[model samples]
Target: MSRFTELKREVYEANMELHTRNLVIYTWGNVSQIDRDASVIAIKPSGVPYEDLKPEHIVIVDMENTIVEGDMRPSSDTKTHTHLYRHFESIGGVTHTHSSYATAWAQAQMGIPCFGTTHADFAYGEVPCTAVMSDEQIQRDYEEETGVQITDAFAVINPEEVPMVIVAGHAPFTWGSNAAKSVYHAVVLEEMAKMAYLTKTLDPSRAPLKQAIIDKHYMRKHGKNAYYGQ
Candidate 1:
């Protein structure tokens, strides 16, 4: 059996969860999980429909994006996933999806402003949107540049605090301590995006949730005094 058997299985299930959650249609999304100690990641194969994917089909690649194992081609976004792993040492898994509402926010090139406590409970503040990719960046390396766009937007924001982002003119990417958590964030982000869109449509003049409330909600779940779960 492969040493990466368990890692591949976990990543495979996470990818399936994206489909199960209705966050992806056809082959529109991918998920990856790193085995830091092994310097490898098991990710979904390119163009494989969720209905047909199996644990053995998961592709394993090294930190430098070289194929480490498996017969299939890793995700076309493999470079972006590798770049993020190289840069964000703290994250263990990453997810990319074209879910409707989050992608709508990305297409509009707008950051998701915090409009309620539900948003604050997860993201500390606005879910940032990356600047549109430049022609040079697109020509250079589209996927790697996508990773650069995300890291650049996070120059001030902590990935641990805000686990999700929307690429301008693209879609959403989320990361977390593991594959399941990353998918959870992806679901949370889509819901937040939907709610924000409706809130704006209902009251275009609605102001952002006040800072005091943002701080309160965020802290209750994430601060040193966090008391959210059992």
Candidate 2:
């Protein structure tokens, strides 16, 4: 068996979780896990239905986007995932999804505000939305450019601190220490997007959660002196 066998299985299971959790439908999403030491990533094969997917079906690609293994083509968003793994050195996995409420926020080109503690528990502040891609960027290597657009949009925020972002007119991308966690972040982003949307509908004049409260919730879970989970 290839040494990458286990990693391939992990990536395969992560992709399946997206389907089981209803985070994706009809192959509208992809998940990838990177083996930084090998400089390769195992990702969902392009357009394959989740039910038909298997560990050996996971495509492995290198940093330069060369296929290293597997019989199938990597996800259509391969370049975006490649660019991210190249730049976000600390992240080990990435997931892209058009989950409804989050995609709705991306379509609206609005950042999801930290309107409650549930959001702050994971994200420190607003979940950023990338600026719309320029015509040239959209026309040239669209997938790779989309990745650049996301990295550029995050210039002011720490990717480690905020694990997710919505691309303007596109969808959400999330990353974490590993493939499983990336899917976890995607689920959290979707629920928070739904919550924030309903919140605004109920009280249009509502402001983002107060910074002190944001600090309290965020810190309790993530600060130097954190103590939220056991």
Question: What value of lDDT does candidate 1 attain over all alpha carbons?
Answer: 0.96
Tens-digit per-residue lDDT, 1-230, candidate 2: 88899999999999999999999988999999999999999999999998898899999999988899988899999999999998899999999999999999999999999999999999989999998999999889999999998999889898988999999999999999999999999999999999999999999999999999999999999999999889
User: TM-score, each model?
Assistant: 0.99, 0.98
Q: Where does candidate 2 stray beyond 4 Å?
A: none
Cα error, residue 139 of model 2, in Å, equals 1.7
Assess candidate 1 and give its TM-score to the true structure.
0.99
lDDT tens readout by residue for model 1, 1-230? 99999999899999999999999999999999999999999899999999999999999999889999989999999999988998899999999999999999999999999999999999999999999999999999999999999999999999999999999999999999999899999999999999999999999999899999999999999999999999
State residue 65's C-alpha deviation in candidate 1, in Å: 0.8
